[model samples]
Target chain A: MKKIIKPFWSYDVEQTEDWLQEMAEQGYILKKLHRASRTFYFEQAAPQNLSYRISFDRNQGPVLASRFLENGWTIAAASGKWQILQNSKPANEIKAAPVRQGVITHNRNVSFVFFGLLFYLLGVLLANLSTLVSSWLQDGTVAVEPSPLWAITYLFLALTLGAIGLAIYSIVKIKKSNQAMLQKESGIAAAKWKSSQPTLEIPESSGRFVKKAKLGWMYAPDRLESWLEKMEQQGYQLHHVGTIGTVFYFVKGEPRRMSYHAEYMSTVESSYFSIYEDAGWLKIFESWSAMEKWVIWCREYKEGEEKPRIYSEGSSHLKRARRMAGLYTVLFLPLLFIYAVNANREFQEFINEGAALSLFGLLPAIAFVLFLSFIYRMWAYYIRLRKNYSVFHR
Target chain B: MNADKVMKKYIPMTETAFYILLSLTEPRHGYGIVKHVEEISGTRLHLGSGTVYGTLTKMQKDGVITVFADEERKTLYEMTDLGKQLILAEIGRLKELHRNAVKYEGDFL
Candidate 1:
């Protein structure tokens, strides 16, 4: 038997799965796992081909375990809620793998917990900072504690912040993997035809496709949607959306009328695609964004045909714009305030000292302007939507 | 859960919620609801498991749905009285919608 210790191995599920598979191929089959110490125990075996899947179960119940066994998966090792299931068949041949919903849900819950921890740590840091500030106010010079516990406390804080960062990083990785898997799922991969909706047609214009970069497009999705619509009218129809949803490929063609909608879903439930597809909208591109889903839906219609809309009438879409503006206002207020304060301090320092402009001071000013522009754009976008709403209402 | 609060929130129910609540006429598990929704919708609607799970979790928290472990230890979900009241109110609204649509069908056509 061989015991190996690897800390935080479960953070990257794909990496751990591959590593375990390699170990198995080398005749070191996983026998057991130590949850607390992050240890893996391996038993000697004949070198063989195996497929390992690392899955997390929110319920951590017998149901998932029994399901895996029914599908010919061996429960090689279990650690708390995470289980390593091994199958004799290669991954492609295996008909059943653990459901992705559990892993996605688990990652969401884990991120929330870590965010709470991060807040708690920030509170601790603030308390320490205030303590130092109060002491500095009492005395002209800074004082240092000679105690060894001070070093330990600083080290502890650093480690905790690192761990929280790692948790967030891994959660993002899991979310991306979940998105990849989601694209292959039944509804997302292909819209089923109950009749009516046009298939996603990438117009091939004889090698005349142009790729336009659209980074941060979700910030002003309505603008991007309208821009794409304008392009279609100008005879440059969208051929396909890039894999990351940042770059768009448009093919030159005859001018055609098209409607584009960049829909932001806080949480995409199953059936999201079908309801829209039933209404004849095609999914041109989709991206998993910060645990939310952003889909660019398209539909082509002839003149005199009623344009399809998620909000078919009234100022509902305008209200949505206002709500988005309100949300960003609330979320970015503190960060904006911090940047403004930093910039002001830098400005005062530069004026009083009459020193050369410093990069450190300039950074806060630049960041302040950047965030200010984002907030301003949101408000401007809202105003545009409201105007568009009134035009329709009129 | 307060029937009034649930009624306020769920009136003019979304198609997904209506179908999910409709499925609970029989005690069903989470995935079972998804399958039943598809079956009832004639394969037009495919409910994502995350969507169903999240909805169930919210409903459970609000006391709209109650769950009990079956013999196989799978949690079977059924509607509570509050949920029944909410669904009935939704059905009333939907009936009104159908009536109005039927009455005004000529103009649209």
Candidate 2:
């Protein structure tokens, strides 16, 4: 019997693994993992003890998959960059392995994206600060009445707050995972499987449009693919991606194993889709944000057919990473400059107020600290990529 | 490639790199190398797939190892002459360290 569980969001690979194992022990063996929707699908089976482990890798190619198989780890489910493996033996019985470089790369990539998102949210807040203050001066509150401006202000506040919270959550999760991996804890613990009755929930049948915003252009492709996949599994096929990528349009469809790939490009040409089409890929969604231009394509995974890759060569992969690093630098440097200018202005204004601090004055200081930390994190990521890829250049 | 330059470049190699290079003395695919490394290290060094694949990529790019053959989905790799020389150099360095430790062995007892 198929069962659906409530959606949960977590960046901690260990916690997610533990939860999945718990479900399995309760007699719900995970059939598929839907990370985008934070949902899991399970097939009822006789309660059996199973061990679950998670590995994060952006490039989960055939070679790595084969290697894991040879090591007696069966691929349970994969969502975006995360792969879940199961073996009958306890995880500790498995040899302790060094943390894969891919885990580090994944963590770094997530951090860089979170930094970009936080910066953008801060910029929006700062841009609206004067207007908000002026409105408050004129009327006692920022959002006074039913108007487009007030409505937009409220919407922006909600979205930005949500985005900031997600960014912080992701950062903390990445940090915790990194520490665990570094400590040689095999990246994640083996979850003890048990058997129990399956819990049920009604699946949404009708198509719906969800407004979602993701931070970091480079990191969104994997997430968007998984999200779209989850929606499709719920009988909602993604029909359109909104201009800003905040609104996703979906239509009802049967659940299918649809392969999605997000390619980064600053500009789109008809020739691009033509190439992928010739290789059996179909253009599904495209979005151009200030920080990134992504074209998402999907194809059905034919039985016994090799999975397609956007970049087959190692050199090409390195080049793409380098381009992303350059774009991140370009995007963040300007934001840093704007922050500097704003901080100076705020300092001068506060000085003119005879050094008395207000909540308004304190906001910029907190934002400045956040921006600095974000910059440092991005720099560390760039340095890591450079160090790792330096041998390729030679 | 110059042996001295190669040695200087890869002198203090990581244990993963050292074992990988040692395993490549015979042509082996990714999984083969991993199993070989585990056996030779007496199961002390369990090389994960990611480590092996990542090291193979870096080693191939650095000219220390070359793709010897492609067996369907698996790619077989063998150490280059420079790689062999670097391994010998690493052994020589290890031997000297071992000799120095031998002199201090009695102090520990």
Candidate 3:
């Protein structure tokens, strides 16, 4: 009484990272890597004392095809249609690559216009509350005191407007970056699709970066030495091109650096590399223009038109920093506002003249603003990490 | 709900959870909670996942965020009565600290 179960649903997974993560969480183990087919086989023991096969196509997001039936393991013609092979075929007939465990998925984006609107609303509420309460705390006497509520409210409203504007701008930037990534990916897909001739064979290159020019940015000191060892095994001559501050540059053979200038890279745009360099270190012309240029060159010449992996890293660092900044403010703003209210001599002058005071009312207002921003960012990152983890796992 | 219970131990309150529970007069998941903490504080506190996860684990154990629902696989978290009370208490403690800082330091941001 054996059974083979076909897949129930298949759709383009919005994010490949997310789909694979879901599969991993569901206890699928990568048993074999069918590299030639660009697919992987996952084995999981069923409720009964039997095993099942789930095939995942790398390019097609997380397409899980499972079967158990009578055949040892089903196979089909390598039709190269990028479709999951459903019909039965012999298992021994197909060669499978060995499984390697490395990726541990758990990974986690953004908008401007919608977020700006939301933050603008929040900034309004917070700014108003902060001012209203600050003023109310000022005037001790209810009757004679100028409420200042209107003034306070308007000030906060202005702040909220500012936040809204900033948020919108941020949203636009993020959207543009995302759009660029999508365009690049689609372009790659198109290229792959167009070049789908069966006669084509991927040439074997033993070197890390095929291009001689873009070696500087790719020459990360911490990891590159060992990575170069791997290249050395692959028969590429590893050369030491001298140290540019902390980063040691390497080439296939001895490449000399004329001069190294440690200066701020205003254009670098990624905080991780910025953080990695106290000040951006630019090597002289002739070989590696900038670390980024090198990375771009390596990815293009070696990885072949595949977008460089290091580009988004900077954006991620900036994103993380911004996220932290947002959360920290939320937790501290109320405390800050409360302190501000209590300390402002102008506020106290009104209080001394006699007015109704709410004890630290300005605090919650600041807290409210902070909370709103926190919610927005947390939503953005969580969506990303979950998706990333899913793809890596898949 | 239980103020004393939370205060019973000197929990090295993580920047994330301290802020997440602090963020949740509203519901937030991973990134939502982080952003909320930052916005409210005026860019003072930034909580990463290590801190966030620790906070969630501690608060969940302490009944701060009772499971609300799942938005996809992400656990949508809301503050419990106890959690709110704890945050309020923290606010109060912070307010008192602010007062002391203002009186002593002359300027408090």
Candidate 4:
């Protein structure tokens, strides 16, 4: 029997894994995850106890999946930026040595997501600043205006506040989880592999086209690849991807082994697609979102076919990281300056005019707080990339 | 680079890197190296596929390993002369450390 659970959205990796395990214990084995609809499909099984581990990566492919399979771990399901695996036995009992894969421990990936959110918040702040300036110039004073501006201002403020709260919550939660993984806590043991065991059979494919609407976030290539691969396993081939990658169109095809590579490029050249095509890669999807564009390519390899990489050199990998870090810095620095200057001006106006501290009056403080957080996150990301580059350079 | 320089550069190699380099003494594919490392270490060190693939790419770029052959989905790699030199230097360092430990064996007890 097939069952579909809808409207399940989980940002926390551990919670998602636990929820999937709970479902498995109840005889519902996860078959596929649909990010567009926030839905999970499960196939009925004999109700077995299983441990689920979620891992995050940006460039995961079939080689990684094959390693998991060789180590006796089955890829159960995948969703946004996460790969979910199920082991029939406990982690420790499976492998003598511990595997140090933790979704929360990926500092660089987490910081990238934080930076993306910061950019959005910065855009909102700038939009509000413009309106506030125009209003002050028209009224000849920084007084409350009776217009829809107040509504827009407050809405933007609320969003900024909400983003800050979510960022703090995520950082704290990930830190705690990383510590727990290091301590080998019962709740967060590192994922391990046991003896090879046959995975639960998935239901046969029903040849039908399905359209899914979902938003793809930054630093989430692994999640997208896994989701597409799962669909392929169920006899669905991604037909066409929407412009922003929010709507994915898939058609029925035979289940096969496929690999996907997601590369970020601001500009796409004809030669770029040609090179990949020459190497047996098919340009599957192109997505653009808020100053970031990603081109996803896929290739189906038979059991013995060698896997190809878009970036085969270590220097290329490091260069990509450096470029991304540079992009974040370039986008962040100007916004930081603008927000700082605006905050200072607002503070001075409040002092000179003896303005009452309203929500508008508190805007500077909110902006300053966000600025500090963005700096901290960017600094952390820089340090992480530097450390990784150092290792590779050696 | 001289042996001393190579030693200084790679003396404190990560366990993953050390095993990967050692496994490349013979031409082996990515999965083959993983299995070989597990066998040599007696299941003490389990290398993930992602880790192996990444390290191999780095090693290749560093001139420590070279692609010996590409068979469909698997690429076989072998150690280069520089890699061999570094491995030998590392072994010399390990031997000296062992000698020092043997000399002070009774101190801890």
Which candidate ranks first by lDDT, i.e. highest?
1
The CA lDDT at A2 in model 1 is 99
Q: Write the per-residue lDDT of candidate 4 for residues A72-172, one digit (tens) a residue.
A: 57777776556667878665554311133324335434745876787787777888889989988998778765897778868868989898777767655
lDDT tens digits by residue: candidate 2, A1-394: 4646544333556677777778788888987877777667788987767877666654344234343454457778777877777776666554322123455456657777998899898888887888888888997876656666877867878989999998887777776665554333211111111111112222334424443455543443455567766777777766666666556666565675677766566433222333344344555556634225676777666557655454433444455555665676676677777777877778897778677667776776677676666555555554654565676557
Any runs in candidate 1 off by more than 4 Å, and if so which?
Answer: A1-103, A112-173, A180-207, A242-246, A291-293, A313-323, A357-361, A390-394, B10-81, B90-109
- Least accurate stretch of 10 residues (summed lDDT) in model 1 chain A? A186-195
What is model 1's DockQ versus the real complex? Answer: 0.10
TM-score versus the correct structure, for each prediction:
0.56, 0.41, 0.25, 0.37
Model 1 chain B, poorest ten-residue lDDT window? B67-76
Ranking by DockQ: 1, 2, 4, 3
Q: Which ten residues in a row have the lowest lDDT in candidate 4 chain A?
A: A186-195
Worst 10 residues of 3 chain A by lDDT: A99-108
What tens-digit string does per-residue lDDT give for candidate 1 at B1-109? 5777877777777677788899999778666787788899998766643346556766766778766433332346778778888888888888998999999999988
lDDT of 3 by residue, A1-394 (tens): 1122212111121233234334444555334434354455565543222222222322222322221223233332122323222222333432221010001000001232456477658866787668777777898533445676878867966876786766666555444443343334234323443354224222224344343332322222213334544554454432323333222333443332221212222122121121212111121221222212222111111223322222122333334334444554465567666655554644565478655545464454455555555555544544554466557557
Per-candidate interface C-alpha RMSD?
11.2, 16.6, 15.8, 16.6
- Residue pairs clashing, model 1: A270-B47, A270-B48
TM-score of predicted structure 2, chain A: 0.44
Give candidate 4 misplaced runs (Cα > 4 Å).
A1-11, A63-67, A79-81, A90-93, A96-102, A105-108, A115-142, A183-394, B1-20, B23-109
Rank candidates, TM-score, best first: 1, 2, 4, 3
